[model samples]
Target: MKNKKAVVYVRLKEGVLDPQGVTIQRAILNMGYDVVEGVRSGRFFELELADGNGDLSGKVEEICRKLLANPVIEDFSVEYT
Candidate 1:
């Protein structure tokens, strides 16, 4: 059987106010990192699944779309290996 791995990345939609990112950017500027412009935060998820001949990809995507991400405010992608 082949081993399967899933990698998920979640990020806030564009135009959203990212207070954390803004705060980090300000700190960097204060620390003399003049070239630092901005920062954005996101989430990463790694999952392992038993080999199932590609049957689990759809289910995983569904999980991400329905529960892991807010469809109105976030976007996510899943990669399998």
Candidate 2:
């Protein structure tokens, strides 16, 4: 029985138009931050699981694949700590 911590990160797939990121980068440049080359926005999720069997990773992965991420346009990664 182990208490597990999970971190899920979701990001837009490459080749997708990220207007928000582009806009932010432009704004940074305007603010005199010339070294800011690019920007990409993503999401982070931290969770704790109380499963005794040590099978939480599979379940969390499934949850991310099914609900947290759109398989066609997004990518996700899970880390257990």
Candidate 3:
């Protein structure tokens, strides 16, 4: 079987407050990189998956929604590589 990899991206949805991102943006400004107007922080998970029933994507998305991300405050996207 061929190897399969998945990357799950998790980020705050729009209109949500991101204190960490705001802090990073402030630090960048303090460092004299004035070109950066804003910043948004996010996280990703790399999953090494075994190819099984041709529905890996669906399962991954379900995993993301149920475990990796908070459906109310965060949005998630999945990428297969």
Candidate 4:
């Protein structure tokens, strides 16, 4: 069986409020970092998969939609290697 690696990135949808990111940006500005324009917080997940799993892409998307991210307020992308 071959080993597979998947990376999932979860982030708030555009136009959604992100308090954490806002706060971080504020902190950066307060620290006198003028070059910093914005900050966005997101989640990163690394998953290792065993071989012989059918429909790997489908499975990954399902996992992202079901458990890794909220479809209503968040968006996610999956990358496999």
The candidate scoring highest on TM-score is: 3
Q: What TM-score number comes out for model 4?
A: 0.90
lDDT of 4 by residue, 1-81 (tens): 243989999999999999999999999999989998889999999999877875577778898999999999999998778
Per-residue accuracy of model 2 over 1-81 as CA lDDT, tens digit each: 364788999999998888889999999999999998989998989888876766677788899999889889999998888
In model 1, the Cα lDDT at residue 18 comes to 84
Clashing pairs in 3: none
Query: Model 2 — which ten-residue stretch has the worst lDDT?
Result: 50-59
- Of candidates 4 and 3, the better by TM-score: 3
- How close is every model to the real structure, measured as TM-score? 0.85, 0.89, 0.90, 0.90
Query: Residue 54 of model 1: what lDDT?
Result: 51
Candidate 1: misplaced stretches above 4 Å? 1-3
Candidate 2 or 1, higher lDDT = 2
Q: What would the per-residue lDDT of candidate 3 be over residues 1-81, giving only the tens digit for each residue?
A: 333888999999999999999999999999999999989999999999976656578778889999999999999988888
Runs off by more than 4 Å, candidate 4: 1-3
